[model samples]
Structure formats: structure tokens, C-alpha cells
Target: MIQTIAFYLFAGLMILSGVLTIMARNPVHSVLWLILAFFNAAGLMVLVGAEFLAMLLVVVYVGAVAVLFLFVVMMLDIDFASMRAGFMKNFPLGIAIALVLLAELVLGIGAYRAGALALGTPDGSAAPIVGVSNIQSLGALLYGPYIFLFEMAGVILLVAMVGAIVLTHREQKSVRGHQNIQKQVRRNPDEAVVMKQPTIGKGIEL
Candidate 1:
């Protein structure tokens, strides 16, 4: 009974949040709602005994992706009126795309209701390890047979991050108040310090 209640609560909240995410006028609010939806979906995953998936949803989607979206929305100078006008202009195309998606969804549902498509028989090659938690099992799989692949993925991501930084980096010309170490090192005490005793009524010359 508790599980059922929790499931319904999470599901309802997730649905409501998803709706609010789309209906929100403010992009930041939409991102917030999307984050909320992700949280509720994570809750549902937890209830379904997929705690690893739940953690991923919260940590990866909610923590990183949603936060990035929120920050981008908040930081960007979005002209909503012009955006709305563009949306209106592209309304027909949007509707057509939406209808195509709807048709695909309907077809998928119909296929599922009729019978699951025979993808392939499970050969037990990727079966979960017994007597271990799901996360431990996942870790074993990741760090065992797929360790090299996982390491390669990490390397790829690192390269991409470096590339992005390099691409976005700008070299500023004639930056104010910037210290030139070469100039400083090359300086002579004679030129650097002009020790002059000034008269009582006269200002010192530079």
C-alpha cells in the first residue's frame, strides 16, 4: 500500500512537473520544473527497485544537466517577444513535427499492446551478477569487461572539454593593468626609480 501510494505520488508529481515545464513562460521556471520532474521520476525509479537509475537521474540529470539548463537560461539575453513571434511563424512546422511524434508514439503503443517485437533471445552474457546489489553489479560490469571502453569514453570527454576550452578561449590585446613579466625583469633601477628631492613649493616631475 505504501509502495502504491508512493508510486502514484511520484508519477502524479512527475506528470504535473512535466506539464508545468512546457507551460511555463519563463525559461528558468521551465528548467526548474524540468528538474522537479526529473526528481519525481527518480523517486519512481527508487520505488521500482532501480536505485542506481534513481541516483543517476538525480545526480546526472538533475544535478548537472538541469542545473546547466537553468544557468544558461538565466544568463542568456533571450528576447521572448521575438522568440514567440518566431514560434508563431513556425507553428505549422511545429505542429507537423508534433503530429509525426504523436503518430510514432501511437504506433509504438499499438505494437506493444499487440505484442513485444522479438528483438533477440537473452544469451545471459549481460545478465546481472547474483548476490550483489545492482550498483555493485553495474560497477563490476563497468570495471571488468568494459573497463577499457569506459576509460576511452572518459578520455574522449576530456579531449572534448579541452577542445571546447581551446575553441572558446580569447586572447585579449592591450589588456589594462596586466603585468608584463619580461618588461619588469628587463627593467633597470635607474629608469624604474627616479629619486629626486623636490623643493618645498614645487611639485616633483615624473
Candidate 2:
């Protein structure tokens, strides 16, 4: 009874927050609402006995992704009124597209319910699968079955990261980087220092 009540409460809160996340005028407020939705989704996951998923949703989604969204929304100089005007202009087209998407989703669900689509086995069935544990299964699939694909993905990501660095990299004539490192490593006191006797009031010029 307690679990059921908690589930309903969390589900309601999640839905409410999700609606608010889309409906809020302010981007920052939308991010806050999204965070609230994540929190409630985590609660729902916990209620369903998926503690690992709940923790991932809370720690990763809420803690990291939502925070990053909040920071981006806060830092960005977006003209919300202008965006709203643009959205208003495109509202009818967007609604028509959304309705089409909704219809497609409903058709897909109906097909799925009627067993027309061949999805994988149901949640818990007595099948002799290799690894049932989340981390273990993910690791086995990543390193064993899809190792080549994984390596290719890593290479692609590496290329993208290097491309980003190359795009943002700039050379300045005033900023000496490599020369300073070389000079520091091979620095000699005799070359850098001078010993001279000077009068108390007069400074000696090097």
C-alpha cells in the first residue's frame, strides 16, 4: 500500500514537473523543472526495485546533466521573447508535425501490442542468457562482442576531440611556450646572472 501510494505520488510529480519543464518560459526555470522531473523519475525507478538505475538517474542525470543544462541556460544570453515570437510564428507547423508524430507513436504502440513487432524477450523470462547483471553484461558486450565497434567509436571520438582542439588552437607571437620550457630546462646561472659592484645610490646597467 505504501509503495503503491508512493509510486502514484512520484509518478504524478514526475508528470507535473515534465509538463512544467516544457511549459516554463524561462530557460533556467525549465532546467529546474527538468531536474525535479529527474528526481521524481529516480524515485519511480527506486520504487520499481532498480536501485542502480535510480542512482544513475540521480547521480548522473540530475547531478551532472541537469546541472550542466542549468549552467548553460544561465550563462547563455538568449532572447527568450524573440525565441517565443519565432515559436509563435511556427506554432501551427510544429503542432501539425507533433500530431503526426503522436499518430505514428500510437500506431507503433498498437503494432507492438498486437505482436507485429519482434522486440526482445520480456523483462524477466527463464532464458539461458550469458550475463544478467547490468555492469557485467554491459562490459561483456562492449569488450567481447562489440569490441571492434567500440574501438572504432573511440577512434572517432579521438578524432573529433583532436579536431575541436585544432579548431580552437591559436598561436600568439607574444606568448612564448616551447622556448620558455626549453630555456627553463637548459638554464644556466652564469648566462642568467651577473655579478657587479655598484654604488649605493646608482644602479648598474646590465
In angstroms, give how far residue 84 of model 2 lies from its true place: 1.4
Instruction: Give all TM-scores, in the order shown.
Output: 0.80, 0.67
Residue-wise lDDT of candidate 1 within 99-139, one digit each (tens)? 99999999998887889755578888768889888999899
Off by over 4 Å in 1: 112-116, 175-206
Number of backbone collisions per candidate: 0, 0
Candidate lDDT values, in order = 0.91, 0.86
Give RMSD to native, each candidate. 4.5, 7.5
lDDT of 2 by residue, 1-206 (tens): 99999999999999999999888999899999999999999999888867778889999998999999999889989999998999899999999999999999999999999989998765543322464755555566678767999999999999998999999899866554445766588888766757679899887746
Q: Quote the positional error of residue 130 for candidate 1 in Å.
A: 1.8
Candidate 1 minimal-lDDT segment of 10 residues:
117-126
Clashing pairs in 2: none
- Candidate 2's TM-score reads 0.67
